[model samples]
Target chain A: MKYCSHCSNEVTLRIPEGDTLPRYVCLHCQLIHYQNPKMVVGCIPEWEDRILLCRRAIEPHRGKWTLPAGFMENNETLPQGAARETLEEANARVEILDLYAAYSLPHISQVYLLFRAKLLDLDFSPGIESLEVKLFEERDIPWNEIAFQVIRTSLERFLLERRTGAPVFHTGKIDRSPI
Target chain B: MKYCSHCSNEVTLRIPEGDTLPRYVCLHCQLIHYQNPKMVVGCIPEWEDRILLCRRAIEPHRGKWTLPAGFMENNETLPQGAARETLEEANARVEILDLYAAYSLPHISQVYLLFRAKLLDLDFSPGIESLEVKLFEERDIPWNEIAFQVIRTSLERFLLERRTGAPVFHTGKIDRSPI
Candidate 1:
C-alpha cells in the first residue's frame, strides 16, 4: 500500500508496538493495515456418480477445469460463500455437506475450503465466469487439467474416501517456494 | 475507506461490472479493493486430562479466559498459525492435531479455526497478551468467563467429543445481531 485508505496519507512499514510483524501504518492516522490470507471456498458438487466442474473464463488458470470456487466475501459463512461461488460460476444449486478438505496455500496466501455438496438437480449451466460446466465421473475427470494442486488433492481424497461410505475432514498445506 | 491505497486517489463504492457486490474502486487507478473475512486460528491444547487457557491482558475481554488465538498472518499454514498463536499467547509449544472445529462469525467478518493440539511440555507461562496461563479439566473450565462465543462452543464440543474417541470436524456460524 502506498497511501493510507483512511487519511490519504503515505503509509510506512514498521513493527507496531507489542507486535512482531511489520505492518503498513498510516503516517497521519496511525491506522494499521493488516493483511491476512483470503479463503477460497467451493464444493465438490456431487450427483449420484459424478461431480461438477467449471472451465474458468478468468485469469490465473483460465480455461482449465476447476471446482466452482472463488475468494470468499465478507459477511457470508463458509458454506454460503461456497454455494454462492457455485451459483456464480456454474449456475448449479447445491446443499453444502461436510467440509471435505482444507489446504493452506501459503504461497498465494490463501486457504482453500472445499466442501462435499449434494448437487440439487441437473438444471445447471455456465454462469458469466465459466466457459462450460459439466459433470465428470471418476474415470472421466481431467486430472492433468485440474486448475490447482489443492483442488486436485482434495478431489483425489474425496473419491478414495467415498468407498468407505463416510467422508471426514482433511487438512494440509501446499507451498510453492520463493525463487 | 476514503482514499485509495494504490494511487492516493479518492475512491467510490460501486458494483463493478460482473460483480454482484460493491467494492471500493479508485477513481484514478480504477483499482478495486475487495475485503474478505479473516481467519483466527488456535488450538485446544491437551495436557493429558487437562487443557490450557489464557487470561486476557488485552482489551476486548481483559481478565477473561480464552484459548490462545489471533488473526492469522500471511505465509503460514493453518496448523502453523494455530501453533504460533499458542506459543505467543501462552508460551506453550504444541503439536497441532486435526482441526476440531470451524466457526464463521459473520457479524464481525471472521472465521475461527480451532484445532486439537498436544501440549508438548510443562514449561509454559503467560505471554504478553495473557495475564495468566493455566490448564483446566473439563469440570473446572470457566465457562462463564470464556472470551468469545466461538471459543465457548468449540470447547463444549471438544469436551463432549473426547468421550467418543473420535473427533470429526465441526462447522457452524455465530452472529451477534446489529443493534
Candidate 2:
C-alpha cells in the first residue's frame, strides 16, 4: 500500500514493536494495515455419479473448466460460501455434505476449501461469470483443462475417494517457488 | 477505510457494475478495495494425557487462559501457522497431526483452524504474549476461564474424541449476537 486508508497519509513498512514481521504503518495515524490470506470456497456438486463443472468467463484461466468457486465474502460460513459460489457460477443448488479438501497456496496467499455436495436437481445453467455449466462423469472430466492446481488436486482426490465408499479429509500445500 | 491506498484519494462505497456487493472504490484510480475474513490457526498440543494452554497477556482477553492461537500470516500453510503459534505462545514445539476443527466466526469475520499435535517435549515456558503456559488434563481444564468460544469448542472436541481413537473432522459456525 502506498498510503494509509485511515488518514490518507503515506505509509512506511517496518516491523512493529514486539512483532517479527514488517507491516504497512501509517505515518500520521500509526494505523497498521495487515493483509492475510483470502479463502476460495467451492463445492463438488454430485448428480447421480456425475460432477458439475463451469467454464470461466472471467480472467485468470478464463474459458477453462473449473468446479465453480470464488473469493469468499464476509459474514458467511465456509460451507455457505461454497454453496453460494456454486449457485453464482453454475446456477445450481446443492446440499453440502462435508468439507473434503483444504489446500494452502502460499504463493497466491489463498486457501481453497472444497466440499462434497449433492446437486438438488437437474435444473442448472450458466451464470454471468460462466460460459457453460455441465456435469461430467469420471471418464469425461477434462483433467487437462482444469482451472487451478488446487482445483485439480481436489478433483483428483474426490474422484478417487468416491470409489472407496468413504471419503477421507485431505490437506496439503501448493508451493510455487519465487523467481 | 477513508482514503484509497492506491492513489491517496478519497474512496466511496458503492456497488460496482456487475457486482452485487458494495466496495470501497477509489475516485482517482478506480481501485476496488475488498475486505475478507482472516484465518486464525493454532493447535491442541497433546503431551501424554494433558493438553497445553496459555494465559493471555494481550488485550481482548487479558488474563484469560486460551490455546496458543493467533492471526495467520502470509507464506505459510495451515499446519505451519498452527505449529508457529504453538511455539511462539507456549515455547512448545509440536508435531502437527491432522486439522481437527474449523470454525467460522461470522460476527468477527475470522476462521479458526485448529489442529491435533503432539508436544515435542515438556520444556515450555510463557512467551511475550502469555503470562503463563501450562498443561491441563480433561478434568482439570479451566473451562469458565477460556478466552474464546472457538478455543473451548476445539478443546472439548479434542478431549472427547481422544477416547474414541479417531477424531472426526468438525465444522461449525459461532454466532455472537450484538448486545
Candidate 3:
C-alpha cells in the first residue's frame, strides 16, 4: 500500500488517534486504510463415498490436488462463496452442509471456512483454474499431494468423522504452515 | 477506489482477464484490487449464570448494549481475535471456547464469528469504545436495547444451550437486515 486508493496521494503508515495499530493514512485526504484478515471459504464436496478434489493450474501449489475452494467474494454468504468456488473450479453443484472447519493462518492473515457439502451429480469437469477434477475415495485420497495444511486437516477429520454422521465443527490455527 | 494503492495511478473498475468479477485495476501497473468479506469476531463471555455486555460509546448503536466484538485483525486466530475484542471493549479477560455461532451479514459483506467464552475475572470496566460494561443474568438481558441482531441471537443461543452443556455449532445468513 504505497498510495491512497481514494486520492492517489502518498500514504504514511502511522497509528491513528484512539487506535493501537498502525494503518495507511493518506497525506491529503486523511483516509485511514485498514487491512483486516480475509475469509477463504470452500467446501468438501462429497459424492456417495468419494470426496471431490481439484488439481490446481495456478501457482502457490500448481499441480497439487485439493478441495475446490477460493477466497470468499463480496455480497455473498460463506456457504454461497464455498458453492461458487466449487462451481468455478470444478463445475460441480453441491448442497452446502454445516461449516465443518475453520483454520486461521495468522502468518498469511487468512481464515479458511470449509463446509461439508453433498455433490449434486457426477457430471462435473475442470474449470479454467483446474487441470483436472476427480472424486477420490477415502483410501484413494492423495494425502501426500494435498495442497495446503488447512485443507489436509479438513479432509483427514472429515473422513474420520463421517462414520458417525454427526455435524461436528472443527477449528485450528495454522501459523507458519503451507496454506 | 479511484486510484491504485500500489502505483498512485488512476484505476478503473473492470473484469480482469480470466476473472468474473469487476475489480479496481490500475491503469499503469495493471494490478487488480480484489475485495472480500471480512470477519467480525467476538464472544459470549460468561461467568456463572450471568453474561457480559458493553454499552456503546460510539455510533451505529450508541448507548445500546452489545457483546464485545470488532473487525478481526491480522496475525491472530479466530479465538484470539474474539478474546482481544473482549479485552478491548470491556477490559475483561476471557478463556475463548469453541466457535459457537457464525452469522453471515451479506448486506455489509461481513461475517460474525461468535464464540462461547468463560469470563476469567470480575475485575472489569469499560474501555475506550464502551460507555459501560456489566454482567447481566439471563432474565435481566436488555432485549430491546441490544445493539445488533447477531449479538442478540448469540446471547439467546448461549443461554439456551448452556443447560445441556452440549456444544452445538450455529450458522445463519442475515442478508438485507441490521447487523
Give the interface RMSD of each candidate.
Answer: 0.6, 0.6, 0.6
Question: Chain A in model 1: its TM-score?
Answer: 0.95
lDDT of each: 0.91, 0.89, 0.91
Off by over 4 Å in 3: A163-167, B163-167
TM-score of chain B of each: 0.96, 0.95, 0.95
DockQ, all candidates in order: 0.88, 0.86, 0.90
Candidate 3 per-residue lDDT, tens place, A70-167, comes to 99999999999999999999999999998899999999999999999999999999999999999998999988899898888878888888876865
Which ranges in model 1 have alpha carbons more than 4 Å from their true place? A177-179, B177-179
lDDT of 3 by residue, B1-179 (tens): 88899988898989999999999888798799998889999998889989999999999999999999999999999999999999999999999988889999998999999998999999999999999999998899999999898888777777877776875888997765554
Alpha-carbon shift of residue B93 in model 2 (angstroms): 0.5
Quote model 3's iRMS: 0.6
Q: Which candidate do you rate higher for lDDT, 2 or 3?
A: 3
Greater DockQ among 1 and 3 belongs to 3
lDDT for each residue of candidate 2 in B1-179, tens digit (9 for 90 to 100): 99999899999999998888999999789899999999999988989999899999998789999988898899888999999898889989999998988899988888999888999999999998999999998899988898888888777777777887877778988886321
Q: CA RMSD for every model?
A: 2.0, 1.9, 1.5
lDDT of 2 by residue, A90-147 (tens): 9899998889988998888899888899999999999999999999999999988888
DockQ of 3: 0.90
Residue-level lDDT of model 1, residues B1-179, one tens digit each, is 99999999999999999999999998789899999999999999999989999999998989899998998999999999999999999999999988988899887899999999999999999999999999998899998888888888888887887877766788999896311
